[model samples]
Target chain A: MLILSRRKDETIIIDDKIEISIVDIKGDQVKLGINAPRSVKIYRKEVYLEIEKENAAAARSSDALASLGDLFKK
Target chain B: MDNDVKQISIPSGLYGFEGLTKFALTRASQEPFLLLKSLEEESLSFILIDPLYFRPDYTPDLSDEDLKEIGEEKENNLYALAIVTVRPGEDPQMTANLQGPIIINGDTLTARQCITSNPKWQTRHDILAEIRSHQGAESC
Candidate 1:
């Protein structure tokens, strides 16, 4: 992992298109401001990983799905 | 038939499977749950549900940046679909991954899964339980 030290309002440019800046820092929480091309998508690393794990788990056979029997009755 | 399949491009793909760009939305055995299948790999597919159908209260906020990312001007154009996780032979229950919903642009047909700002929705939301909860309240 590449770590860089930047104070509030400091910005980092990537590929000359994407710009990430530290908007504010208060105690443990840090606010970031990102400016990138419309094509670029951003997400939290932990949240992305959680979705990926669920996606993989959902990728099961149709037979397995049907064989699971019925959902709980009312 | 080939005409039945809905072709879509996932610019960022789904989390771990970012390499796959071309995908097909095919009908699943279950109603309201479509199969998000990868055209490149026959074995790759996921059960997807429009979370709104089950949880109408769910309206995740879409930022201006997120809208532009998918080439959308209106927030409504970005369709939200939640991935459904099913465990076979044991609990036999289905859960929707509400933490991050997949948003697709109607015009561009490009999709990307994004995290919701609303913390109420979690990674696993029980569909049947939600239905029952709503149904139970309606009786009162």
Candidate 2:
């Protein structure tokens, strides 16, 4: 990852459509503000990773369909 | 949990949105969608979604027991549905919200979105693959 240092009110531009700004820095926590188009989605890294893991797990479960079929057998 | 079978119509399409309904072409030929039908009528129109499509970071709310029942490992099932695709040429793909899921009361039919503990069910699933395989031997 490209790491950069910036003070409050500074900003980073991406793909001409998204802008990330440094809002404040308190202790170890740094507050940020993001600007992007409505169609674009932004999320935390951990959250994204968690969801990706879930998506992979769900995709692997062939039994779900089988169970649903079992539900119909009754 | 009452299973009083009723001939409820699924709007012939998902929520009757003209654009989204176009996808329902594939679903029409598929078998009756055997969902965990809600007891309430209002919660009838629901879809499961994939969390990665929306907020890749989501956690569900489920007890240890509920987790076992749904066959999940944690209290991390929750998501919402913005849109679902039911096409004729493609698989009937319904996106599930990994952040939230449509939960219905089988007895009252009153549905509410619930977070599942199961990490195995996506918000969106393609029903076409299942349908294709189920077709008669000649079609295959």
Candidate 3:
């Protein structure tokens, strides 16, 4: 991992296309502003993980398949 | 064989799976999770699918003009959809997006996922995985 230290208002450029800026800093909290193309998708890590979890959960239930198998077999 | 069984007809268009009789999801320690299952129809097959398989960021593409035609607010109201796959044996197979979650006006069943900003759905999910799981279970 490439780690760098910078103060507020400072910016970092990635691949010449994406930019990350430190917008504000408070005790134990820092706000970041990201500048990326529309093609780039940005999502909170927690939100993404939550969605994935729900999708997997909904799929695991066997009620749908059990009913279908019974239908076709008869 | 008696010929008194009534034939059921499933609509050709996409439909929401509000009450599927059976469905299951499989978790692989190293591989992607799989959803598989069957429906209540005798000749119809339902495939359990993971929404992530279709679109990582599944947003409906809609223009401002399109929203006006339906009298819908762009940000406040949008449609989502999911796809489901069905088959009737080793012949022709059909798949539907069970993600996107086709949004419809509560008052009207007219539905479409052609546009929306929701990114929590998928376009395609496989069915064969579910069949294998069920078959494997029955053998044991």
Best by lDDT: 1
- Name the 10 consecutive residues with the lowest summed lDDT in model 2 chain B: B21-30
Clashes of each: 0, 38, 35
- Per-residue lDDT of A1-74 in model 2, one digit per residue for the tens? 99888899999999998999999999999999999875454545654454444434433332244343333343
Task: Tell me the docking grade of candidate 1.
Answer: acceptable
Ranking by DockQ: 1, 2, 3
Give the alpha carbon lDDT tens digit for every residue of B1-140 in model 2: 12334332222222112122111111111233323332333323322333333334444553443223323332323222322323222332333434434332223222333334455544444443433344544385
What is the TM-score ranking, best to worst? Answer: 1, 3, 2
For candidate 3, write residues B1-140 as lDDT tens digits.
01222122212222333343332223322122233223353333323333334334444555454343334554534433343434445552334344334343222223333322445333334444445455687699
Q: Comparing to the true complex, what docking class would candidate 2 get?
A: incorrect
Model 1: per-residue Cα lDDT over B61-124, one tens digit each: 7666666667855645668888888775546668898887878887788877777767798889
Best by TM-score: 1
Given the true complex, what DockQ would model 3 score?
0.03
RMSD of 3: 15.7
Indicate which candidate wins on DockQ.
1
